[model samples]
Target: MRRHLRKLRSTPAVVLLFLILLFLLPYDNSFSPRAAIVSAVPALFEKRWWLINKPGAYPVDFSQDVAVLVKSGIGTKERIPSWLQAHEHMELSDLLLIGDFATLPGQEYQYRDQRLPVHDVLAWMIGRGYMAEDLDHPRLQKYYNLTRAIDREDVGAAQEMSGSFGWELDAMKFLSGMELLYSRFPDKKWYIMADDDTYLIQPSFKRLIEHFNPNREQYLGNPVGGEDCRFGHGGSSIILSHRAVSHLTSDREYLATAYRESLDETWGDKRLAVALNRLEIYIYEEYAAFFNGERPRTSKITKERLCTPVLSFHGLSSSSDMLSVSRTFEHATEQVLWIDLWNIPTSDKSDNAHLPKASTSLFDDPIYDTGHANWDYVGRPDEWTQSVEDVSSVETCKQICREERPDFCLAWTWDSNEKKCHMSWWIIKGDQAEGRTSGLNVPVVKGLVRSCRP
Candidate 1:
């Protein structure tokens, strides 16, 4: 009986010893020590932490409050699948896809298994006599020709005409879509209008709008153009509170005036702003940084933007780029700030490894191999430029960047043709230039990153 009691006591000790050994052992594909620990003590690591680690397992759904509208055309219709794939995890309440083509009223198209309601701006215009019976009307000629070209399925003619007349169609689409959205979902608190390429960071966007009153008229986005004609850059994602949309759509006279202006305007976004300006609803310039006009890889990670939560990224070149960005932030438990983008792994092979956390490291190393050949960091207004004696090579340009005060030089680009080296105070991932090379001051960037608020 005493021996049996001793065995029972020893069992608990043996089990404890086994657990200790298991935790200390190196992890493999089948098991992770960190995950094991998390599983063992569920109370210590909260649900938020667990969800952060397991991406796509627990998605934040904001379907009740907001509706997203994607503005696209037949030319870009193929991109819709990728766009849908990117936002698959975001449980949006209503996603309406609008274009310039004609569709029967209440028609829906099945794409990638989702039955999406289609809004045809062209059809709406025809029904409303905007593309009137008297096709000879000076303003209606272009619309008439474009409609004829589309009807005949003349791909070449349609493409050519669309290049010139598409802006007008797009403006009409935005106005009509707004009205339709209000009619379909008048209860929605907010509506977002974005291009097919634009990627909205749902969590950050939700966080931003939550602070504002949906009942108030709000027009918000990344403002562009002059103050007189300032409008939200459409590709950057334009946001409208329910009241704002109501005001724009409810006023028929305002809509007519806006449509007339659209015929003369070259861009739809500008026309939308012009229409709203008459109603005293201007773009909320304060939150401009939240609506980025650049893609993740090319976005400028300046000091001013480090702590700001990113709401959307515009001008993503491909669907793959969108998917990659979606994967990068899929598991984020908190709002994704601009600073967070800097640590994104360069490639899939380094998926588990983050770039060394940005910190104030004193070591000044001009990472030579990091220079991108045939690429240039475009000069900003605040950037410094100097003529380099050794125009034939990029070495001197790199040395100049390294020698400058860390605060003054975050990145440098050398132009072979101009024989000039430009150093920017902020880090801007620029575009390709045939005869240029660009590199970064790593240590200075680390310091800049460290300066941002958590």
Candidate 2:
């Protein structure tokens, strides 16, 4: 049953093109008149602020500029040689490196600024601090997609220099790489991010820039994962908005916040994905369907139909000979079926290290605020926390509870209807409670509750 369905879902090109065109065609409406008349039921796209239902032409790629960044945790001794040379033949700019600059044993290779021979011309990338490392395989399996290729012998040594390792380190490196690259590559309009292991297809620059046009204004990939997706950790090859970049790094608060949440005992990209889900972000995800508990676990894709090529994160190829670069592009060839995660799981709700709990409704609280690092924290909600909800008949008694345990209740004094006692949990330690039922607990939700945790 499933196999056949998968086949059917993998619709053919001609048919898929017809469908996208159908939705794209002009109709007696606003936004995109041509598309509206063809495929989509007008009602399906009703409140789509980004929807082009108005009588107009399909959105074009006015935002044509681009830049590409590569994150390598492993060295280039083996596979690095091929990719190091790939940028030269393509239309993309010099490779922007992020992560450990030198992964070679004894001697650190200068990947920060690409190290092509000086006369090699491209060797100029070496001057910029953006660099790549030699990532190994096993470490790749730990998180979603940020590459980690340090030597097993030196992993501990690297950790000592900076407990600031892994995706966090890569993120910092990318942030720094972008900051530096932005200055060097003045013509670069938008930034394209990927890992050293990722085979970046040629001209992905155009595909992504079109999707992120400032005027188009819809959230772009790597938007911010949801409670389950974990921000910055959802997948590799995220297309970020320039505004999104500042949004993440602009505040010291957000940077510090993401660091704390990311270090949680249960922390990882997935955990961050959940936290990110609450933030304003999106992505061109493939696993979104399967990972987000969508009913169908599989889907197909076809290109040529003009399906929006925001970007594709995963692909399947039975051929052992296929290169990761080519295989990823193959998926790009089809009409990529997407799993629309109801919640990005955006990138704000990771568990806390010491805070007993994080409220589910971070936005609901007055002090609760979200940051660019994509983490939300109790910011002192002020009267707005309960005042608005109260004026709106939402809150009667404004209270904050900082309990270590929900099950730690006396049960008798806690009255539900009277609003006599409202409580919030302040987490102390989750790693310590892992075996006890509170393993990953971190005050999961916050709102103007009339009572304590039910």
Query: Which candidate ranks first by lDDT, i.e. highest?
Result: 1
Count of clashes in candidate 2: 96
TM-score of 1: 0.73
Could you list the CA RMSD of all candidates, in the order they appear?
16.3, 20.5
Could you tell me how far off, in angstroms, the CA of residue 225 lies in candidate 2 after the best superposition? 6.0
Tell me the tens digit of each residue's lDDT in model 2 across 1-454. 9999887887687576876666654322235434334234544443222223242233323223456665544322233444454334343435455444443343433343445311110112223311222223233233222223233456454444334335443433434444445544445445555544443433333433443343221223433445445344323454554554444445545534544343332334343333233454434342122111101111111111112222433221212211323423332321221212111122223221221212244324332211112121112223322211211111222212223334421110112223232222221111111111111112333221111212
Looking at model 1, which ten-residue stretch has the lowest summed lDDT?
45-54
TM-score per candidate, in order?
0.73, 0.38
lDDT of each: 0.68, 0.33
Q: Which ten residues in a row have the lowest lDDT in candidate 2?
A: 293-302
Candidate 2 local accuracy as lDDT? 0.33
